[model samples]
Target chain A: MQESVDLGPEQCTLLLGAGITGRVALSSPDGPHIVPVNYSVVGEAVIMRTSPYSVLGTYGRGSMLAFEVDWFDHERWRGWSVVVRGRANVVTDPLELDRIRTTWDPQPWAAGARNLYLRLHWSEISGRQIGVGWDPVETLPVRRAV
Target chain B: MQESVDLGPEQCTLLLGAGITGRVALSSPDGPHIVPVNYSVVGEAVIMRTSPYSVLGTYGRGSMLAFEVDWFDHERWRGWSVVVRGRANVVTDPLELDRIRTTWDPQPWAAGARNLYLRLHWSEISGRQIGVGWDPVETLPVRRAV
Candidate 1:
């Protein structure tokens, strides 16, 4: 085991853009819940579509949420994680929705009438990579969409 | 896209036991944060070690937190996730420490003085699998160790 290495802003943003799915951590009435959702990174904000009855749909609007994307290698005991913390808002504007839909839209995996779209405007981004000298971005199995 | 299938207790426990790494979501003064850690299941409780200043070590004790483990297949548009909602407790008993040390102790990946051990006693466990019928455990790239 080795001390984790802090990732810079560029590294954090690149890692977030590489993955299509990430976990969103939000505070609910019961407690904190982490739910995995497919998301798209447009500018610095994360955009996702969920059902109106879902946790993110219900309590995510105007709330501070943490979005995390991570991958680990058990063989080498190394992992890299990026967390984006910010306020979420419901995207109702037709123009903004059109831009996202044409460029990079988050396609929901679960089947339903997902009319609610939430955009998490990131205020803070941080990450860490564990293990010895190695470039996690180069070694990552998943690559950014071309 | 398809409707998510609810997983039963037996399936959920089996899935949780299969993974060595998972994300822990907890509430702090700042907001909700998700941190990935290597963990082990001793019966129904999750055993983990973290630094005293770490989020899990500081605010997690006696706090209701949500722990999640999941994997996704982008090509198939499928994934499975198991969530454990519970109250976390610090492990101080010498005897209990010995038991965990002897069997399935969580091996912390980040090197540091991790003197604090936290156990999350699950009060509620639930899971969901999305996409057409398929065993996520079977299709998962990472298999359980013998």
Candidate 2:
């Protein structure tokens, strides 16, 4: 039987930054809800855009949330996941907004006006891999673009 | 930009059941968390197992949670996600447990004594797709097991 390995902080950060999409969980009126968002990692924070009325925009700001990205190999039955625990906030700084656009704007695939720049700053980052010694993210089946 | 399509409940259930793994979100003491779990669909419930001390086992029972399964086609930049909102509970009934074991048993890859059988009964389900007519679940990049 294979054992799970704890990933280092640097590997966690690298894999988290390379993914264009991940799921973000937040508390909603009905219950706890999670949804995928296109995100760009800037420094110690993740930036994504959504409409002002979306579930994320409505309840995400000023709330502590979790963001996760994972990849699994079906043939080998191996997988790894990076989870980020942080507090979410709306991006309101003019300079930061300009820098976000200049650095790399997160372009959400949904067809709507994704005008709200939501940022989730990392307070804790951790990861684990079931298949040790294998570079899972770099060798993804589809090689998702960074 | 292509318009997003709203999928019916039946299509949502089919896609949700076809994926062997998904992210389950539960509210924890620190904040809301999301984690990947190997799951199987039975009747109106999603069944999986976890260690009794894990975040899911500790906080998931009797709590309202969200389970999501999705597949994205990077080449076309299109994707769809099915989200199910429900209350989770520990499976303690003998007949139901026997049925779960008889019917396809969910095998968690993680190495541990996963004694707690967690069942998330779906109270609501909804889905949306970016590419209107294409079957995203059937054409998954890696084709995750059902």
Candidate 3:
């Protein structure tokens, strides 16, 4: 079995910056809720836009949430995953919203009035990579026999 | 802006069967956590394997969790996402484990002693799709200009 490696803070941050889409997990009154989101990282915070009535928008403010991104190369049987635990806050300041709009505008693919922008201030960031010695680009022919 | 459509239970099940990888959300004492996982659906339950001491393995049993899967077509600015809310349970029956192992062998890429298998019994299933009239395969030339 190939070994898995933990990624450092700097490497996790780099991976977060390179990602465009991720899943955000939040606790709701009913249960744990998660959804796919388009996001942008700004100054150690993850920013996303959603409808005010959406699950994320409703329970996001001052709530503890987790965001994750991952890449998997199926043929090579290797992948990397990053998780960010944070407190989410609504971006209400006009100047800050405008600055974020100008710097990194997030366009949510789901068509709706997604005007509310939430910023998650990360308290913990962790990452892991599987199949340490495998080449991501190379396809393994041995798997074909299975 | 394109219209968004809600998918019915049958369509949601179809989408779930088509996906192999998804993110699972669980609430921990610290906060809500989300991670990517490889899973398979069998008899209305989603099954995945993980290390016994892992966060998911430790906290998943009898806990309310959310599972999500999505497919995005960036070129056409369209996608579909499905979310399943369920309670997780550990598969302890040797006969059932053997059945699952024979039917849908979950080969987790992350190398470890992942002998524990968790099954999620879904209570709610919902799905949504963006860009109702747009073709998923058609490339939009307007995106190139930006």
Provide TM-scores for the models.
0.96, 0.95, 0.88
Q: For candidate 3, list the clashing residue pairs, or say none.
A: none
What is the Cα-based lDDT of residue A32 in candidate 3? 94
| Candidate 1 per-residue lDDT over residues A94-120, each given as its tens digit | 999998888788888887878888999
By DockQ, is 1 or 2 better?
A: 1
Superior by TM-score: candidate 2 or candidate 3 = 2
lDDT of 3 by residue, B45-92 (tens): 889888889889888888999999876665566787889999999999
Q: Any runs in candidate 1 off by more than 4 Å, and if so which?
A: B140-146
lDDT of each: 0.88, 0.86, 0.81
| Candidate 3: stretches off by over 4 Å | A133-146, B133-146
CAPRI verdict on model 2?
medium
Interface RMSD of each: 1.3, 1.7, 5.2
The DockQ of predicted model 1 stands at 0.79
Higher-TM-score candidate of 1 and 3: 1
TM-score of 3: 0.88
